[model samples]
Target: MTDTLERPVDAEPGRMNTRPAWLALFGAIAAFASAALIWICRAGDPSVHYVSQLGATGMPTAPLFNLALLLLAVAAVLVDRATIARGAGYVVGWPVATTLLVCGLCFGVASVITCSPGCPVPFTPGSLVQDFVHISFAVLGFVLAIVAMGQVAALRRRPWMRAASIITLVAVGATSLTGAMIALFKGDTVLGGNLEFTAATLAIAWFGVFGLQVFADHRTARRRAARSHE
Candidate 1:
């Protein structure tokens, strides 16, 4: 009886597990650690120099920063795969998976094609084509994260997740918008840099939290299934 009851939860192939959650957490920690190392290695005013500048070509921190992005990309990809394994019951499933895939791609592209020194805005004076590409993809990645958050917010079955996603969507959207406006209008000032970093940190942390939620939801579903069988 116990075996029969537990079969649905334990025997299912490709069920969302703890690995992806741990990967997400590790990725977030690595990104923050790399950023801290970059700051320590290169003394620059965070307000004036954007985060991308730390990872720009020729900077001492470039390798570490780029590696961090790659880790993040991997984490996103793994999370997307786990989400897909949840099957059709997941609300906005395809959209969330697609957005995560695109976000991962963007992060990978940005890691490989780092910007020039100063990380100038796209199409501005002294900005290289690669700079334009890097910035565009990075911005798109964050925007897509916001999209995914909105989609997750629609998960009515998961009230905690819905509420958390809504809050994150608002906070990340506000910070990203403010930073983007400052970058576009006034160039990279201290305020813009701070806001940009804030948005990124929030987004990355949310991703980690998202992984935890996925794990919790899966466990809860399994337990409920077992109880129903009993």
Candidate 2:
């Protein structure tokens, strides 16, 4: 028999779920974490051509991403323990550390192989090849963004939340495709190189936001859980 006693109190008309509200909050955390990862990677060296700047800028990138990835990995699994995504989320958690290590190695190698001593010249086939290699890491970032945004959309409360999640997902996919194109057309030409890099940076920032949204979603979810309990 259905237990009326177990039912939560009368529904509040426009109130959002504590869980969902908490979920929305996770998005912000994830975004900041991603930015942190970028800084970690870039912190190494500034004078040399690195991830975005010159030094170890890419250093923070990996660590920050791992932080957000871990957070999303943890909460996503909890919220959908019965869903197929639960299995996927668990898989995501284990890879967080590996991703940082692998991305670091790939980017570092690419950096060295691409440019001669620093990364001043730019063109060299070596650099192109390196860019190609690093593309895979970028692809992973894109994939994770897709899943994170979709998950949020599925759990969102406000109409705008769903809209934002979907828009971000679409942007991630489009940016990835464009990034691939940019990777293919590398050179010293100001038009090609700068444009591609600008696009890539924008895409990365977008992915950062995707992580933020994921954190926000988690916060919203926790809130809902608390509300229900009350």
Candidate 3:
């Protein structure tokens, strides 16, 4: 007797689903748009303030920034479904995907319940309970995303996936350390804020790269299938 392997019901062998790729692209665009809007709407040097401060209470960019977060959350949910539907060649497992979904939900919560000005953390003077809640949501979301990336990197199946994940993890980690130093020791605000922004941009770009990879896989599969028929 010979053994046959099972495949996802929604996916044809060797064919990559394009929905997740498209969703990720859309999410990245929305995220960048929100950041851009903040830069344009604000008066002071954006590099000196935390990114969250742009969306804090009474800021001109707050409304659109929050709106973008909501859009991203929606995109993330759709991406999760699309990823599962792809059924093959996806780097992360369902557990990791679920983690991403939770990360998206956390962003949504942060959008709805924004922090006060300066976006102070818990137990700080002039900090409201909602501020802590907002910060918690944002921190949890980013941490989960980093964790998911680490999990995918551990797979080491695709060279590009592994490299991208590792690079993003390192970039994010380095900036996070700077951010901590700024919080703890009054480090260079400009450097910390700029590094934080750059890390976030890199993460979003990497996600877009993943989407493009899926698209490439789809094209390759089509080419192979066509050659087989010929």
Candidate 4:
């Protein structure tokens, strides 16, 4: 007798299901759009960075931007769950999910706790705790996003997904780096802000592309299944 191997019902020989990718894309778009709106609304202020503006107490629109971040976080978690359901192992899925969840929670918390006066300035001896928490989440969320991108790139078997993962990694990296530079060295507000915005745009664009790819894959799979039935 010969030993037999079993494959998952939805598993394709060389491809992973892309449904999750689409979800992630949606989340990315929502987050990106929200961030863009926030930036545009605050562009007039010569003294404020996008990150700082997000939590600034005086900014009436801060809550809306924070809401966007929360939505993005939710989308990230959904993407992770979808990937797992499609048969990517526990190892690949959990970290992504956890990171996204953490990011989401952080955003949700930060949204309600608007920062005190002089927020973008480094937290000094008397800076409010809310400002510290807000900054922490902003930095950590981007860092985790970078990690999730790398994880997705490594675990996904599809060529397009892998490619998107790489692009996302680069975009997130640039965004994170620029954000850090702005925080640490207090770099040129205009240039750093622009670069951060560009990087974020690239990341969102990749999410949209990934979603399209996954949708295309879903269509292709359906066609193949139909042919096989015939």
Candidate 5:
């Protein structure tokens, strides 16, 4: 009798687990697609030091690229929430959630706050506060992205997730270092931009893959549960 009562309850999680994954997956696709469009639109612009620079005033692709960042931010938050819902909550879940939240909010704010034309050049003598704020948010968002990746790598039980997390960590680390170098030297803008683009791509890819995996895992679990019940 107890087994009969508990079986349905036990099956509930499996049945419901895929919902968050779907949300995350949608967010990932939106982020990546928008970012790609921005890059394509802004290609060959020498003045842009990083992807975020594309969203600065006077840039041709400013509005579109900024919109992309907003989409990516939303997607990141969804992915992080999904992680928490999956029962990895005790592990890296909370850390991932917090970092992604930071990433999302920073990105969203930075999108609205346009940088000066010559951003990453130490701000002009009388730059607007928005310029500095944009830089701060971008830097913090990237850093949190790296932290989230590391935590996910350390705590995820799935082999594929660990592998993806490790790869993302490497990509994000290289990108962050390259960005820092650009900031210090104010040189190699192209290289810095490329690295930033790559890092963003890897981040969205990881989120998409992770969400798909979670969704697939839950679907399998549900199927198995249904069979067992039969």
Candidate 6:
């Protein structure tokens, strides 16, 4: 118990290792996949309305996928804890490292919502706003992920991370532009489609990478802490 509290102080101040990062990353990938699948399952029509009803009582395979999402969230939490252990700045008003932790809850809740035996009844076209809300949370979380990554990248001075940061910054720019383009060209389905796709994908993938990094780093920090205490 004593060891658990102090373990974070033992890591390379703000550095996280690589092994566990992939684990959480795979989990993050699963999270996006599950969210997409669940959305498709509920989608009465991708264009206008998304039906909440899953058609059948329950999908047998869904259980496994939902579990996968849950696992990814746990992995994310572990990583977030590690960032905190390393004294990684939260950035802005909130702690950036903790965003990954919050995303775990978001993904878990989304999974549970998907797991319900029946989809939401009387699906309204207006529910598109709900979808937007989900996207907003994801975006907010991803922004924080970048903050954490920046800290890690700064501490390590890794070239790959530098490249990743540059790409991510561009993604952030393009994502916002795409989202606006989607709203602007509501009539022109072609451009809107491309914009939405680009923005949403970048947002999901960014969060996904951050989630994995947090999981790997935090777990390693814990191990190092225990060793130091011994």
Most accurate candidate by TM-score: 5
Worst ten-residue run, lDDT, model 3?
A: 1-10
Give the poorly placed runs of model 2, Cα more than 4 Å off: 1-30, 33-135, 146-158, 182-230
lDDT tens readout by residue for model 4, 35-100: 566565556454555555644777665566666556555655555454334343324546555655
Ranking by lDDT: 1, 5, 3, 4, 6, 2
Model 1 vs. true fold: TM: 0.80
What is the per-residue lDDT of model 1 for residues 1-230, given as tens digits with 9 covering 90 to 100? 22321233333343424453344445445444544554553454343357788788887778877876776677567667656545554447464767888998998898899999888877879999999899888888878888888888886766787898999899988987898899779876788877877777777766766766655555665656656656
Q: Give the distance in Å from residue 184's predicted Cα in candidate 5 to where it truly belongs.
A: 0.7
Positional deviation of 83 in candidate 3, in angstroms?
A: 1.4
Better of 1 and 6 by TM-score: 1
RMSD of 4: 5.4
Stretches off by above 4 angstroms in model 5 are 1-18, 44-47, 93-95, 120-124
Off by over 4 Å in 4: 1-29, 39-47, 89-95, 204-230
Clashes of each: 1, 55, 0, 0, 0, 7
lDDT of 2 by residue, 1-230 (tens): 01221222222543433443334344334434544554454454332232432321244343443343343333333223212211233123343323333433433343333222232323554344444443444445445545645654554244575677677667656745564565456533434434434433443454345334434544444455467657
Which candidate wins on lDDT? 1
TM-scores, in order shown? 0.80, 0.41, 0.79, 0.71, 0.81, 0.50
Give candidate 2's error at residue 229 in angstroms: 5.0
Candidate ordering by TM-score (highest first): 5, 1, 3, 4, 6, 2
Error of 5 at 77 (Å): 1.6
- Please give, for residues 1-230, the per-residue lDDT of candidate 6 as tens digits: 22442346444544534444455556566546644654453343344211222321265445554554455456456555544544533333455556667766665554454523433222434344444434444445445545544544443333565467567767756755665665555555546544545544454555566555555555665566556656
